[model samples]
Target: MQNLDILTEDHYVLSAHIFEPRQNNRRILLINSATGVKQQIYFSFAQFFAEKGFTVITYDYRGIGLSKPNKMRGFPASMRIWGTKDYKALTSYIKTNFPGYHKFCLGHSVGALILGMNKDSEMFDEFIFVGTQNAFVGNLKLRTKIEAYLGFGIVQPLSTKLLGYFPASWFGLGESLPSGSAFDWRTLILNKKSTNKLLEKSDDFSRNLTQKVFVIRAEDDLWLTEKGVLSLLHNTYPDLKPTYRLIKTSESEKNEIGHINFFRSYNKKLWKIIFTRLEEGSHNVED
Candidate 1:
């Protein structure tokens, strides 16, 4: 695994841990978690991708993980303090520095949202949304949903306001949801109006963005559902070909896995299937 060199370390202080294979030809950037989850969460995935001849780079989002935090602001402030700008800077760094590489991106949850927010087409050759769902509806159980909203939408914000940072136990959301992200997420659920406005500003980014989108969903995901995923795909540009598949249930469990544990499937069949698909050299978007 090759180490990442920090390029443009300024207010955003962009940084990444790069894993370049012995025979590097393709570049795949892992957009890290925004919920203060460690970049190490994706270390195994990085190693796996690097071994496949893809240059993999994973880094912490601003105010999360190894990257420095901006404590100058409080809760929601800290959450919105970076995100879009950091990704923009990171994309620029990769394009300018890493030439002669087929670029791809795999973003998780909010990481995927941020990619949509940036709407930069020239940044990569293809984009993969892993663990991404239509919207945040907690889980199958109503109680889980309530708990999430209370913990994330309500209690978490209150905690951030009082404590100056998001409480860690708040189910990975932390205190990042302010009016902006929260509102954006809400609009995503309610309709595509929010995404439309954001896209309108990007100056026909859809034309540049080949419809080839790969969305990976968990069979037992508590948040995003098949219905939501379909709705989201419907709102996306028609030219982009978006593919959705369930993370097959394990033979032993006879049930599916949760939103997170992408690696620890009932067995390895789920991931193996995904990796195999990635290995096939074609974008489903055109069809």
Candidate 2:
């Protein structure tokens, strides 16, 4: 694995790590991290794909992980910037540095949500979305809805307003989030129309995106309910018609592969399924 700095067109420097395969397979995989999550969490998965003959790259979004600004308290970072600017930079880097490699993206949660925002999304050959959802609180499960209400409706506003940013780490909700990102998430969950507005550009991109998309969701994911995922796909990619799979707990020893556990080393069987499916490249419905 090689660690390097990626300079974006907007001038923000992002920290990234690359895993090169022993033999080039003419394919490259870019793993995008979920909201508030660092790229290092996907290291094992990057190495796994690398071992499978894929050149993989993982990087931290600005204001998060290694790419965080010197002054994080009032950093001007938002979800839109993450999708539009950060992802654009990463894709540009891939295209300029590794020409001729078939590009594939594996995104988790907000990572997948941002793909539609990329103007160059059509360049990718395939996409794998895990735990991606619309994030509307009402569409979530009862318990999750309650949690979302508290987090987005109450906690996020109060925290961001008081501290100039969201202290998510202090609340055990992953890393701290910038004020803009926290408010953006709050708006999406609190108002259904917010998601619609956010996805307008992505919807247009999806309508013309010919490449296949594979969506994977676990039954026990508290953060993303089945209804939420379906609504998200329908709204964002009404014309793309992506394939999907809902993994049952019985499929794994843990008996519950929630939002983030699917990539853990213990879930090797699940990984194998994903690898096989990617190799196949054909769409099949699986409920």
Candidate 3:
């Protein structure tokens, strides 16, 4: 069954959904998505985790989805705004409300970056990152890099400056991509180094984690490249080096799933490796 609740922090109402199994489990899994994506995006995975005997919690960011939008009139809404504040609030809420369960986190893309940025906490027992990119498209083709810089570096700054904030819908052909959220993609370039620095400040947070981390990647993904992988390795918690791999051809060719499609795709096989990683505890999954 599914339950709904509200968690208010930093003056924003975060809408949370809980998926419970028939019997209560001692473990609870928190699913965090990339910027602008809603908690609803993880309905299937939430249900799957619940069915596997984990109570699952999913919520929207402060300025996105059902939660309250950032009320500031003239400032762009970057992922940095919501990542540090909203995720910390959600983590605190879960640690307080579900103290009995062994908490775990599953972060997708930039969601992993946000988790890496959080202050010290024992709220999460383990962590999994899907499609996490460490650095901004460094391994991508020259044209792709150019487009990112031009789109984010030039256009984003100008748009946010002129409009106070980028609109929620702008970019691509018929794409309803959020303007301020995408602009924050530029922040990724800046924060990539900062994320690494965060680990140094809290030596124990990285060294004393309760469970090891697992990283899953898709080979066809244009986002996280070899350079990003290096960055992730550099910043990861001590004794918790991530195990990772590219998606296999069988799933990719059959489903034509790429990047975001891995989560959004309706193929059960896509999650088989993920489940296997969870079962093995310390195993690294890769293509």
Candidate 4:
């Protein structure tokens, strides 16, 4: 694994790590992280893919994780910037450093959402979305929906207003998020139609994402529902239908494979499923 400091066109510096296999196969995989989640969370997964002979790269968006400013309270960052600038830079890095390789992406949650936000989806050979959803608060279960409203609707706004950032760490919610990203998420959750205007500005870039997409959902994930996942895919890629898989928990599996646990080493079965799908390079649906 090699650490890299990548600079975006906008001069924002992003921290990244690259895992290369002993024998290169001219195939590269990029792992886009979930919101407020560090790139390191995917390190073991990257190593697993690398052992399969595919080069892997993972990085944190600006103002998050290792790329965060020393004082994150007033740092400026937004979902748009994450898609347009941060991801664009990472894509460029891959194209320049690993030319002639078949590029694939594994996007988690907001990671998948940002892919639709960017105009460069054509650059990827395929996309694997894990626990990805539109995040409409109403789509959450009744209990989780109330939690979402309190956390994102009330706590986030109140915290950002008072501290200039959403200190998620204070509430054990992962990492603190920039005010811009927090506010943007709140707006999206509260007003669903806002995404339409955002998409219209993209000039149908999402539609241009013609490559095959594989969506994996965890049955026990409180944050996502099947309806929300389908809605997000339909809105983002109306022309092409993505292959979907819903993972069911088994008694043999000692650990719970929740939204975040899929990437952990304990979930070897799930990892094998993802690896097999990537190797097939086509939609192979399994219940």
lDDT, each prediction: 0.57, 0.82, 0.63, 0.81
In the range 1-287, model 3's lDDT, one tens digit per residue, is 55555544555566788888877656777888765676777888778877777788888765566664545344334465455566777787777778766767888876776664465334565688787766555645567677766766777678756666554357641112345555556556545453454334333244445456777777766655766765665555445556776685466536455556676647556776776766555222211
Predictions: Cα RMSD each: 4.3, 3.2, 4.5, 3.0
Candidate 4 residue runs with Cα over 4 Å from true position: 194-204, 282-287
Clashing pairs in 1: 211-240, 211-241
Model 3: ten consecutive residues of lowest lDDT: 172-181
Model 4 Cα shift for residue 6 (angstroms): 0.9
Model 3 residue 101 distance off true place after TM-score fit, in angstroms:
2.0
Per-residue alpha-carbon lDDT of model 1 for 42-109, expressed as tens digits? 77877776777777778766555566445524423222233456666667767777776567777676
Off by over 4 Å in 3: 1-3, 68-78, 172-183, 190-211, 236-239, 282-287
Instruction: List, residue by residue over 174-241, the lDDT tens digit for candidate 2.
Output: 78888988887787788785556666634335455666778899988888877788887787666554
Task: Score residue 11 of candidate 3 by CA lDDT.
Answer: 57
Which residue pairs in candidate 4 have backbone atoms (N, alpha carbon, C) closer than 3 angstroms, thus clashing?
none
* lDDT digits (tens) for residues 1-287 of candidate 4: 99999999999899999999998877899999988899989999999989989999999998899989999778889877888889889998887888777889999988887776676667887899998887777767889889888888788899899999888788776778899888877765665643444455444467777777889998778788997888787876665558999888672175476788788777866788778877787333211
